[model samples]
Structures are given as structure tokens and as C-alpha cells.
Target: MQRLLVALLAAFDAAIAAAVGLVVLLAPLTLLWTLAFGITADWGALWPLTGTLWEFGHGVPLAVTIPDELLVALAIPAQAASFAVSITPLAFLLFTLLFAARSGARAAAAGTWLLGVLSGTVVFTAISTAVALTARLDAAQTPLLLAIVLPAAVYFVGALCGAVRVAWEEGDGGILDRLHDRLDVHEDWAPVPAAVVRGAAFALVGVVGTAALALAVMTLFRGGEVVALFQASRVDALGATVMTLAQLVYLPTLIVWAASWLAGPGFAVGVGTAVSPAGTQLGVVPGVPVFGLLPENSSMWMLIVVLVPIAAGAFAGWAVRSRLVWEGTPLGTAQRAVIAVGIAVVTAGVGGIAAVLANGSMGPGRLSEVGPAALPFMLALGLEVLVGAAILLLSPRHRDELAEERTDRWIAEMSELEPSQAPVVPVPGIPLPRAHDQAFDDTAPLDDVRGFRPPTGNRD
Candidate 1:
């Protein structure tokens, strides 16, 4: 049963991945074709062509629109040609092979999924763009063209890339070794189960957090009491101080929590659970008593109040533990804190300034009319600067836990150490480059490096 389930899941994943790869390759072709040929194509003619193309090429009769036909025509042919040349079975195969070579089974699975998603997005965009662009084109030609061209193009490109990737990896010893080295460390951890659980849990938390935040913010805005308070403020130094303090406290709290939510379960889950609204009746969390103190109309206020503490708690927890609940690798305390605070402050300041400028009255309708939109832009820039400054001042340390894993694998491979033993000394023949040398060099051609052979002499 377990084997069957795993096989089914793998098949599903592969299908999705292939679909995505086809789309990615197709989008650019569609875009280029639309630009070159113009949007005024005959849809009636295009539809039949598209249907024929899918039937003959991909062996699937997918329904597509006229504008989509135009795009498909452009993308499909090139993809088909490449696939023919390479003789690869599926588009996602390249990504899978690359991952397998570089980081073993786990990495291969992740890379395959990532590539598949990217491909799918590309295809969706291509079809959508084509439809929008050629809306006014001749209806008959549009459909015929799409039906004939799109599927063939996408499939061919996918196959071509997959074949090329596999061939390249198989031929290159250094590249293959590097991939194996990268994947070696996490052999003990079962990736599929962990990934499935984490993905589902985080998704659930995200939906709940988003709904809660939206409800709270909408409620606060409708109440109108806060607006009145802002309007009634006196123009004295004391008033300014009080106003600033209120803004500082309230805005930061709201912003931080909002940021946490954006960061998802990794950062927000702990915070969300920790925060309690004052009093009874409407707690942020079930069975908690924090919602009672909020004014009847102050939903926004309640949300902010609840989120601020949650953000703070989550940040503190993450800082100390070095790992977010869902993450495999650990981060330093300082890094966690900086990320939390930076995101929160920047979001709140920009959002607040934009709101004020948009709604605030400023003398005779002249500056008020044109200046409101500009305020948000200016605020966004200012917030960016503030966040950058905070990052500089805090000096957060990024712990390269993933890199360490890779290094350990490299060391183990070199030393011929057993999986259970501590990593032995570096092997003699492997040439380990210095950190600076390993940094990416854009000017260097990867193809040339592939043909070069390293010395076989043992350094030790």
C-alpha cells in the first residue's frame, strides 16, 4: 500500500512538473509571436489549426482561445524542433536529473517541483496574454492558429531542455560529484513526509492569519472614532509628542504583526498563538480573552493590538531557537530579530504615511489633490532608507547552515568516511577553492570550464 501510494504521488508530481515546463517554454514564444504578427488574427481559422496541432503533436485536444492560438503558434514550433533534436521524453526530466546529480533525491524532488511551477506560470501567462492581445483580431484565424501550434511547441521545448540537461550532467564528472556532495548530508532525514506536513500546515495557518487580519483592519476603519481623534488633536508641542508616541507604539505593533503574518508559519505561527486581545468574547485565538476591551467599532485596533505582541513573541522565540518551526536549517538570533523588525517597521511607516496623505486635508484643494498619491511614493522611499539603516546598525549574522551541510558532505567524500563516523580529513586529489574564488564570476563561460580537467595530484 505504501509503495503504491508513493508511486502515485510521484506520478502526480511528474505530470504537474511536465505541464509546468511546457508552459515556461511556451510563454516567451507566444509573447514574441504576438509582438511580431500583431493581435488581429482570424480566430475561426486559428481554432481548427490549434485543435489539429494538439491532436497531432501532444496527443491531447486542449481547448484554447484565438489570441492564445497566435501565441501558441510562435512558441510551439521552436519547442518541438528542440525536443526533436534532443529526443528527451519530458520537460521536467532535466530539472529532476540536475537536482539528483547536485543534491541527491531530496534536492532533485524540490528542484523538479520548482521548475514545474515556473513552467506552469509561464504557460498560463502566455495563453492569457495572447487572448488579451488578439481580442480584436479575426476570430476564425485565431482559433485555428492556436489549436495547431501551441501544444507541439511546448512539448518539444520541454523535451529538448530535459535531454540536454541529462546529457550534460552525465558527461561532466566534476558537476556530478558536486551534486552528490551537496545532497549527502540530509540522507538520514525523510524529505517527502516532512515536506508534505509542513506545506499543508503552513497553508492552513496562512489562510487563517490573512482572514483575521483583513477582518480586524476593515472593522477599525469603519468605526470612525480614531479619525475623529486625529482631527481633534491640538497644535501644541505636548500634543505633537503624544501623537508621535501613539503613532510609534500603535503603528509599530500593527506593522510587526502584519509582517509576521506575511512571513507565514515560520515567523507568524508562534506570534499568532501568543497574542491575546484584552477582556472576553472575541479573542484572536479560540478560547482566549482579548477581544472584549476593543471598542465595538474598533476592529482595526483590535487586530493591531493582537498582532503586535504576537510578532514580538514570535521574533523572540525564533531568535532563541535559531529555527522557525517549518525550516530545516537554523538562523542566528540576530538575523531573526532583524528580519522581523525590519519588515514590520518598513511596512507600517509606508502604509501609515500613504493613508494620511491620501485622506488628509491640506489647505485649498491645490496641494491636497495632487500631493496625496505622491505621499505614498515618498513614504515608501523613506521607509526603505529606514529599514536599510536598521539593518546596518543591527549587524545581523546570517548563519550558512545549508552551506555547512554541503561542506561536510564534501569533506566526507574526500576522506572516505563512513556515514556514521565524524568527517575525516580532506582527500588529496580534490581541489577545494577558497571562498573568494568560489564566488560567482559572470564573465567566465561555464561551457569552457566544463571541458577543463583539474590536476589529479594529492594535496595532502
Candidate 2:
């Protein structure tokens, strides 16, 4: 009965998560549409449009076709009237992913993680499919496969992450615990792998932190331009507010692009454009406020920005070195090098993925291709980081460090030894002379060598 109750609760929580994301994105738009168009607004079409926007948020590519008559009447070029809308602001998807993760975690904590994750995922999937089937816009039709697959994929990943977290924190006689125990059993092989992960994490954080700082500084100098573009858009307060919110969600994405720029591959505003510290080769760009931060053909000295990734890598390597000092493991220099290199390689892979996601079309023509080239970005970042890691990893250790490690190992071994192995103290053997017997003799008999003796004040 309790298990059944948990399953039902998981499903209910999953449904609530989907509803929350939908309602949050939908409700405001619905209210704004009513205010803007009043009773004359096609309420039916509005709901469907809201649904379409919701679908787009989950990464479903959208094709928008403007009517031929409307394009011709507006005197717009035929080519500009219809364009693919594949780029998405990921805030809603992030919300849904986090919410689903929470639901999965709650379910896991309740007793059965497997049932919780599976049930929640299934419920979310069904709701997503229903939403997909019901919400179709006349102007925009999403790919049917994307409509079902994308949401399901997000929910499943969230649930898996949640389940893993739960299993790690509180085992359920599960596979995670088993794996953990196995790893623990092989203690000799664990430290380097663990250190590698920690170092990679530190490196990634450094890159992001540096990018954020750069963004803040760039914003300060370019605030006026951003404001000018925002004003030029002429969007109303509500519309502007929505746009601002969407941009905030993509802030992380931009940070990655900035990191790429610092790494030297730079990012694109359109085809044949490159905005790197090395040079600015942009032809045309959209009037989005964020694009205002792009550098205008600056100086050759800016190419020095490529040093940031190398610095980040160095910091990561230094961090690993510090950790290893206390780790007291007998890891070889070669092993350290391998681990550091692996961390850099993984960090590079992350850079590649970020470049791909952060670089995509915001509009047609020159605007279609944006962000950094993944391959170049990844290679440059990885190589730069490896240089830093190698500096620390391949360096010779000081003799003091080796001596300290030896001392620590000795202490550890001492703690493990049995008390029976310790040396014993012998009892005194001489039942020697009484005071009277000693007084009778001019010289006292010599005490046995093994016996305790009193100190004499005289010296020869």
C-alpha cells in the first residue's frame, strides 16, 4: 500500500512540474495578449500560440511561414518573410528540468528510487505528448518527433541525476553503493581519478568566472549602445520585459561564447564573421542589445586574451598539486601527468559542446551562423590547459615533500600494528644490599648492569 502511494505521489508531482512550467510561460503571455488586443483577440488562436511557444522552449525546431499576401502588402522582401526559428531561450526548459529533478529526488527519498524515477518520467512524457498533440499553430508546426522526444529526454536525464544523487547520499541496496564499495576496495587506483575530476571542475569554474568578469566589464563600456538598441526595438514594456527575461536565461550561453573568444576561436554573429581578440570580421549583425558588446575592429594586442585558458589550466594544476600534498598517496609523476592531461581533455570536450550550443542562428542569412567553431575552440582550449597542467604535473617534487610523505606513511603503518609487537620492560634482577650491609663495606658491591642505578654527583 505504501509503495502504491509513493508511485501515485511521484506521478502527481511530475504532472505538477509540467503544469508549473507551462502555466508560468503561458499565463503572462495570455494576459498580455488580452490587454493588447482586448476582446477582439482570437482567444482560441492565442492558446495554441502559447502552446507552440512552450513547445519551442523545449528545443523543438519551429518553421514560421508568413502569409504571401501579408508579405507583399507590407512591402517586405519575399525571402525575409519566412525564416526558420530554431534558436531557443532555455529558461523554461531549465525550470522544467530542475522541477522534474526535485520531484525525482523527493520520490527517491520516499523509499523506492527506481519506481519514483520511472513513474515520474512516464507521467511527464505522457503530459508532454498530450501538450504536443493539442497545441499546433497555423503559422508554426514543430517536428512530431521533437515534440515527443525532447521533453522526454529532459525529464529522463533529470530523473536519472536525481536518482543518482539520492543513491549516493543514502543507498538503497543499489548499484551506486555497490560501485562505490568496489572503488573503495581499489583505494590505490582512486586518488588520481578523483583528483582529475576535482581539477577539471576547478578549471571549468575558472573559465566561467573569467568570462563573467569580462562580460561585466564589457557591459560597463557598452551600456550606451545596448540601451540604444533596446530603444530602437520599440517593444512595449511587457514585451521588452519578456525579452529581457529570455536574454537572462541565455546569459550562461553567452558566457561560454565569451570563453571561446578568450580561447581565440571567437564567436560569430553571422556567416563569414569572427569576433575574436585577434580581429573583428563582422559584415552585418542583428540589433539585439546583447550584440552591442561585440568588439569593433580593435587592436592586435587583444590577442593576448588567449592566455586565459592557459591560466585557468595552471590554476587547476596547482589546485591538484596542493591536494596531492595532503593526499599522502604514492602516485608516480607519470600518473600525475596522465591525470592532469585527462582533466584538460575533458574540459576541452565541454568547451566543444558549449561552442555548439552557444553558436546557432538567431535569424536568417548572415545571422544564421553564430558562436565559435567547436573544433578550433576545443583544440585551442585543450592544448592551452595542458600546457598549464604539464607545468605543475611534470615538475620535480622537493625532498622535503618526499620526507614528509615518508613520515606520514610511517605513522599510518604504526597505527595499524598490533600491541603485542611492542618491546617489553624487564623486571629488576638484583635483590641487592640493605642499608646496613652497604654501610659495612668500604666500597659498595657493583650493581648488576641490568639493574637501575642512582646518579653520582662526582665526575672524574
Candidate 3:
């Protein structure tokens, strides 16, 4: 009965999540439509546009074809009439991922994570299928299969990841428990998986934090340039508002680009453009206000920014090592090395995924090849992180660390000892002469006490 309840709740949660995403899109687009078209608006197109965009936001690529009339009116080139837009605005995707994770965590807490996750995924899949079937945009079309699968896959993956994390930590009394028992047999190796994941999480947070900081600094210094671009665009208040909102949605994507730049691979604005700390090369780039944040030039010395990611990795290693010491599970050198490698791999994998979602076409022609190349960015970041993690993880233990370990061991030993088994200090034996065994009467004590030495020395 409880399991069934959990599944029902999970399905409800999934439905709410899907509705919320659609509403967010629908709200803004509705206002724009009403303002532009007034009473004569083609209200039928609203749902389709919102659904298609929601799908696209979840990483489904859209084939955008300009209408013949609009193309002719705008004098657009025939070659640029249609193009694919695959670079996703990560904000919506992140929202869904986080929400699903929360739901999965709740399910795990309810003691039936598998059922909950499956229920949530099934509901989400149904919604995606309905959207694909009903939301048909003649101008911007998505693959029917991809439209159905991508969003569902995103939710499933997120839910699975969240459930597994909770189950592993809290013991699900099932598969995770069995796996944990197996690991317990090899005490030295048991912590490797958790430590690696922890370290990787730390490293990713550090890298993202640094990227955000860098972006902030750029915005501060280049605020005027961004404003100038906004002015040059000559957009009215509503258009500017929409543009600003669009850019905000892409902030995470921009942060990924910044991280890639810090990693040394940089990214591209066009076919032959490069935006890296090492240098900058460009020709006829788009005049988007966000693009104004790009550096017009860079010195070779700027390449030192690569150290930021390495430092992040080193911090991760330190964190994991500290945890090991605290838990009294000091691993061997080989195990630690594996941990370092694992941290790097995880960080690289995450970075690569971000790169994939952040890179692709924004428009036609030269704009198609935008953002970082995933392979180069991943390899560079992984190698750099590996170097940093190895420095901390594989290094010899310090004197302080050894002392801490000894202290922990002592505490453990003391805690394990029973009261009866506790050691007692022995007192040394001292010999004493037996007292006189006589019972002299109190009445005759003054004259004949045992061995009486009466007033001999001090009497005079």
C-alpha cells in the first residue's frame, strides 16, 4: 500500500514539473503575442510555439526554417533559410533536473526509490509524447522520436542519479546494501567510490564558481560595451526586455563557455574565430549584448588562468583526503591514485556534457560552429585536474597527518574497551614494621610504655 502511494505521489510530482515548465514559457509568450497581435492574434499558434520551445529547451534540436514570405521580405540568403539550433538554454533543463532530483530524493526517503523514479519517468514520458503529437510548428520542427525521448531521458537520468545517491548514503536495504557489504570486505578500497564522487563534485563546484566570478568581473569592466551594443540594436522597450530575458536564460551556457576559455581550449564565435585566454581572433561577430563580454584581445600571460581549474582539483583532493582522515579509512597509495583518476574522469565527463549542450548553431552559416569543441575542452580539463589531484592524493603523509591518525586510532581503541577490560595502575609495595603487640593498660601507660625513651634529651 505504501509503495503504491509513493508511486502515485511521484507521478503527480512529474505532472506538476512538466506543467510548470510549460507555464513559464506560456506566460511570457502570451504577453508578447497579445501585445503584438492584439484582438486579431492567432491564438492557436501559441500552444504549439510554447511546446516546441519547451522541447528545444530540454536539448532537442530544432530545424528552423524561415517562411518564404518573411525570407523574401527580409532579403535573407537562400542558403541561410534553414538551419539547426541545438545549443540549449540550460536554465530550463537545469530546473527540470533539479526538480526531478528532489522528487527522487523524496521517493528514496519514502523507502521505494525504484517505484517512485519509474512512476515519475513514465508520467514525464507521457507528457513529452503528447506535446510531440500536438505541438506542430511548421517553421521550427523537431524530430518526433527525439522530441519524445530527450526530455524523458533527462528526467529519468536525473531521478535515477538522485535516488541512487540517497540510497547509497542511507542504505536502501536492497542492492546498495549488498554492494556496500561487498565493499566492506576490502576496507582500504571501500571509500574510493564515495571519495571520488565527492571530490569530483567539489571540483565541478569550484570550476563553476570561478567561471561565474570571471563573468562577473567581465560584466563589471565591460558594462559600457554591453550597453553600447544594446543601444546599437535600436530595440524598443518590449524587444529589449525579451532580449534581456533570453540572455538571462543562457547565462549557464555562457558560464560553460567561460570555463572552457579558462581551460585553454576557449570557444568559437564563427568559423575561424577563437576566444581563449591565450588570444582572441574574430571577424564580423554577432552584436548580441552578451557577446560584448568577450575580450577583444588577450596576452599570452592570460593563459595563467588555466591554473584556476588545477587549483579547483587540488582543493577537491584536499577535501577527500581530509574526509578519509576523519573517517579513519586511510587508503594505500594505489587506491588514492585511483581516486585522483576518478575525480578527473568525473569532472571531465561533466565538463564534456556541458560543452555539448553549450556548443552548436545559434543561426545560419558561420554561426553554426559556435562554442567550445567538447573533446579538446574535456581532455584539457581532465589532464589539468589530474595533475592537481595527484599532487595532493599521491603525496606522502605529513607529520601532523600521522599524529592525527594515531590519535584517531587511540580513541577507537579506548571506545572499544569494556569497563572491566580497562587498565588500572598498580601502587608500589612498601615494607612496614609490625607495631608492638602488647596491650598496655591505660592506667600504667606513662611509666612503662613500650621502649619508652622518657625526657632524656630535652629535659635539661
Candidate 4:
């Protein structure tokens, strides 16, 4: 496990990842386009498309400029049409994440995770630089710095996560593990970690569940429209398959949009569109099948759906409260409140990040602006969960209730362990006696210690 060898393997892993992702994107596309459109352009021309998609998947924006000649054919008087396309499918990112994680975990086990992550990032940055420099397609432009930095960022995050995960579990004695040990010493900070972690999980589940339910309802109500749009595409099974697969890749992004919707901010498919319960106001949307799920015109009653995020927050708060109640000792009410808010803050930060990733341009013009506002979504979501959690955590726990819980827990533990005493005896006429009770005589004659004579033998 030499540092140099670890670095090399990490780079090799990244290279293989990129190669496989490109192949997956290009192979099916090549076959489908050739069959469907007779490959009007040379096979080499498709490389730029693949390259552009690669950059897109890394969350890089593409500047598209239309040629002047097309304007005349389309009877348009616009001088020069230029717009940015920023819709990232996330499939490439997901693939790289998994690959880099594997590489980093292996490197961490070898005690060279730093070198491994650095090497992979360096290679990825270099590859991205080359692609940005040479992969322009038909007047399309890639941001030079973003192209170099974005993919490397993704790789760095993935590698760091993987390395830390393994390092944490295996006790690699690395700086990360050392810092973790140091942090674990702070009693004041102990409850924060559990509350934050559990709260985040709870919020994630709640928000995602809300989205799923909404999506299901949409599918049921607007099933015909979705089907009609699919039929209108007039594509053969192969084309439909490709389209379906592409949509599947953006599923997580859609879920994020749904979360935004549930949070009351809603999301836009295009610039002027706002699909919220406040009432849907939309223009002509693109022919994406998922767009068919939009309600024609939402009623004012629909605005009540904002409760979804509030409910999600409450769920998260409840989770944090439960964890603190079970695992925590007596703390000041202020401290408990602080712990609950801390969890909300962490979850809000995560939500904001998701909003940022989910919100981006789909294509030129109106389609460019889409998805939720990050700051607003975070604040709204955080406040909701925080309110519910604070109410529960800061409330006084009755001593009786606490005692009952402890007693129940103790009984459960006792039931689980092997008993040290003999087995209980079962009597036909009476209830089975416990081993402890069997050792004592309940009906024995007692001697008086107050000088009064007690019968040595039973009167019976």
C-alpha cells in the first residue's frame, strides 16, 4: 500500500468510471439515433454531444448560440439567439460518486486515502479541462473554470465521504479519526450529534414521502394526460425506452422539486411557471411526459398543501425529541431547546443544498429558470420542524412517566437475559410461583420480637 500505488489506483478507478459512463451514454444513443434518423451527421459528431453531456452531468452550464441562417428559415427577426442550458441529469455524477467512494475506501484501508483522493481529483480536473477546451458543439460554450473545478469538486466530496466512512469504522488513526475522538469528549456536544443525525433522516423521509404521495395523486388524477403525451410522441418502443431511461435519471431532482412544492414555494418547469397549491400559473410547457402531471388549475384549497412541510418538520422534531428523551440525561430546558434547533439547522442546510442542486436551467429562454428558491425553502422547512421539536423537547417530562418508561425498559432487559435462579414451579390449583417466591414461606408462623410469645407450631 505505497502512497504512489494508491494514487495510481485511484486515478485508474476514476478513468475507468468516466470511460464506462461515456460508453453507457453514447452506445445506446448511437444505436438509437442511427436507427431512427439514419445518422445524418457523422459518428464523430456525436462526440461533442457526449462531451457536452459529460460537462452537464458535472453541473456545468452550456451556452448555446443559434446560427443566423436558421432565423430566416423559421421567419424570426432576432439578431442573435444565445442562452444557457444548465439542466444536469445527475446520472454521471452518481456513477462517479459510487466509483470514487469505492476507490477512496480501498485507499483509506491502505492508509493512503489523502493521496488517493488527491490523485483522482487531479486526473478528473485534467480530463475536465481537456473536455472544456475541445468539446464545443455548434457554437456551444463551456465555462472554463467550472469545467475544471466542478467534476473535481464532485470527486473530492465523494472520495472524502468514502475515506471518512471507512476511516471512522476501522479506526485508521488518521487525523479525521483523531478529530472525531477529540469531539466525542465534549459532553455539551454529545446530544447534538444524535439529534442532528436522526432529525436529518426524519426530515428526509418526511419530505420525500410527501413528494411521493403527491406524485402518486398526480398520476392517478392526470393519468390520461400523461398517457396521451406519451402516445403523442409517436416513438417506437426503442425510442420510448431511451426516453424513459433518461427520465428515470432525473427522478431525484423531480423529488426535490416536489419537496419544494410541498413546502409552498413550488417549482417551475419554465421561467413564467409556478406550480404550487397557491394556484398553478403556467405557460406552454415542454413535452416532457412528467410535465403532464401538472394540475390544469389548482384551487385555493390546494394551498393547504403547505402543511406538508410543516408536518415534515414536526415529524423530524418528534424524532429528535424521542432520541433525546431516550438517550439523554437531565439537561436544562434551554439546552434541550438548543439541541432541537441545532438539528433543524442541520436539516435546513441539507434542504438548501438540495434546492440549489435541484434548481437550474433546463435550456434557453424561459426554460432556463426552474425549481425552488434555496434560502426560502430552507427557512420555511427549518422553522416548521423547529417549532414542533422545540415544543416537545422543552416541555417538562412527568416523573411518573419517566419512571414508567425506565421500569418498562428494565423489565425488557431482564426478560432478555438468562435468569440466575431456578425455574418457576407450576402448581395445578394455584398460579405458577416465581423462583424467588418459592424460596420464601408465605404461611410460616412468625416469632414476636416484642416479648410476646408466638406459637412455634402451626395451630392447624
lDDT of 3 at 155: 93
TM-score of each model, paired residue for residue: 0.25, 0.82, 0.91, 0.78
Instruction: Please provide, for model 2 over 1-460, each residue's C-alpha lDDT reduced to its tens digit, 9 standing for 90 to 100.
Output: 8778878988998888888878876887777887888988888887677778777777777887778888889887778766776665566666777887887787778768888888888998898888888888867888877888888778877777777677666876777678778877977655766677778878898888999899989999998998998999999887788778778877877788889988888888888888888789878678888888888886789989878888888899888877888777757876788877888998998888667656666666676787778899999999988888888777888798889898998888867865544333433554444445543433334464466578899999
Please give the CA lDDT of all the candidate structures. Answer: 0.35, 0.79, 0.92, 0.76
Report the C-alpha displacement of residue 172, candidate 1, in angstroms.
15
Query: For residues 233-281, could you state the per-residue lDDT of candidate 3 as single tens digits?
Result: 9999888988998999899999999999999999999899999998999
List model 1 lDDT by residue over 285-319, tens digit each. Answer: 21111212133322223434434323433433333
The local distance difference test score of model 1 is 0.35
Candidate 2 local distance difference test against the native: 0.79
- What local lDDT score does residue 238 receive in model 2, on the 0 to 100 scale? 79
Ranking by lDDT: 3, 2, 4, 1
Which ranges of candidate 2 are over 4 A from the true structure? 1-13, 100-112, 165-172, 181-186, 324-330, 398-404, 423-460
Better of 2 and 4 by TM-score: 2
TM-score ranking, best first: 3, 2, 4, 1
The runs of at least 3 residues in candidate 3 whose Cα sits more than 4 Å from the true structure, single-residue gaps closed, are 418-421, 425-460
lDDT: worst 10-residue window of model 2: 437-446
Q: Which stretches of candidate 1 lie over 4 Å from their true place?
A: 1-118, 136-460
Query: Number of the top candidate by lDDT?
Result: 3
